[model samples]
Target: MTIAIRMPPDVQSVQIGEQAVVFIDDFLTEPTEMVEAACQSQFSPCPGYEQGKGYPGLRATAPSEYSLRLVELLEPLIKINFQVPEQLDLNKSACEFSLTTVAPDRLGVMQRTPHFDSSSPYHMAVLLYLCGPEHGGTGFYRHKATGFQRITSENLQTYSDVYSDELHRAPPKPRYFDDSDDHFQFLGMMPARFNRLVVYPGSLLHSACINPGIGVCADPRRGRLTVNTFFDS
Candidate 1:
């Protein structure tokens, strides 16, 4: 089957605090059938968190054709929207099909909270929603104490100190970060829409709003299927 890919005339962007989130609707013309087949065909259990907390989900190596096409479509946007150099270095670029697996109760203290994919401002994440709205969306947060939305090298120590202190004072319960917790405030939310893509800095504090009732399917087609990519300039 030939996959249909569509690009909007102009991508929409939203700025929250210091973070700029780019959104593109109807990103894939009609990719559900093809992508779902690919995801269900082969998948491996996602690796444990780097800090050895808990596994978030499962991932499958995406097809090279799809990966190459995605990079081609996103590179120019990244350059223009994020203001990266014209000459892009994609040595660290990766494309994969991801599915959420671990339940909220199983999440570790760290997993229960929002997190940054990386602390480098140069790094960015692109997430394409493959499922419908029943699957939860993504959220951006602000660390209430420091008023910091994106953690960086300069503020990492301060963020860490505050985070540690908060954890000690009142530990997070066994659930995904919802509204304003003691430490983080919900700055904004991006609802999950089929064929929608969201791009934001990797340093931003964000989390996937897992719909406990709907999104926990182990089956990729029925679960919260998202194409997650990371790029470093």
Candidate 2:
């Protein structure tokens, strides 16, 4: 399942609020090799959005060679489609192997909601799904109150104020955020597929659609395994 470099990698775009989310199938020639490599690597708890205890699982930094290769292969398309300038800094970018393990009920309020990687529109996140569909995919969200589908520096304060108020007024259920709720509306999900790669602006509101049926597991082979990478200008 190898999608050739073909300049920018073959892509299918899904427009979400003026943003183009590019998804590609058959992204890796040897995805299993990468999976096995990750399984044998060291992993630790990934810091969360607020309280230093957010992500439900463990993570390990991806090999530098692998990150360099991906940046080399995807930069041209990112520059053109995302309109990033030539001086886009790779220093802000990172690549990591992640696995979701914490149960839905064990999650914090922050983990139960959607999040943006950065406030800058120039920040892009490239996610490679190394597991099967049973593991679930990523879902984009829109704030019901502010009607904000994208979170930027300009709207951050406004969105956060309204969101915080709503949470205090009426708390959300302690469960995974895969569907619509009182605050955020579920727009759609990019279904997970083995060796599938998708890239989108990190500013967009998004959450991992952790399948409650599968629960939590630390094993990379049995759990949800993903290659998370970020780039910003």
Candidate 2 positional error at 30, Å: 0.8
| Model 1 regions more than 4 Å off | 1-4, 8-10, 49-55
Q: Candidate 2 versus the native: TM-score?
A: 0.91
lDDT of 2 by residue, 1-233 (tens): 23233344567788865567898887766678778878788998887623525677888987666776687767876887788887866444668898887777777777778988889878889999988999889999999999998999999999989988987888677788898887888888888998888999899999999887673677888888998988877
Clashing pairs in 1: none
Q: Count the backbone clashes (under 3 Å) in each candidate.
A: 0, 0
lDDT by residue (tens digit), candidate 1, 58-141: 777665666776777777788889888887674446577888777777777888888888888678898889888888788899
Pairs clashing within candidate 2: none
Q: Candidate 1, residue 156: CA error in Å? A: 1.3
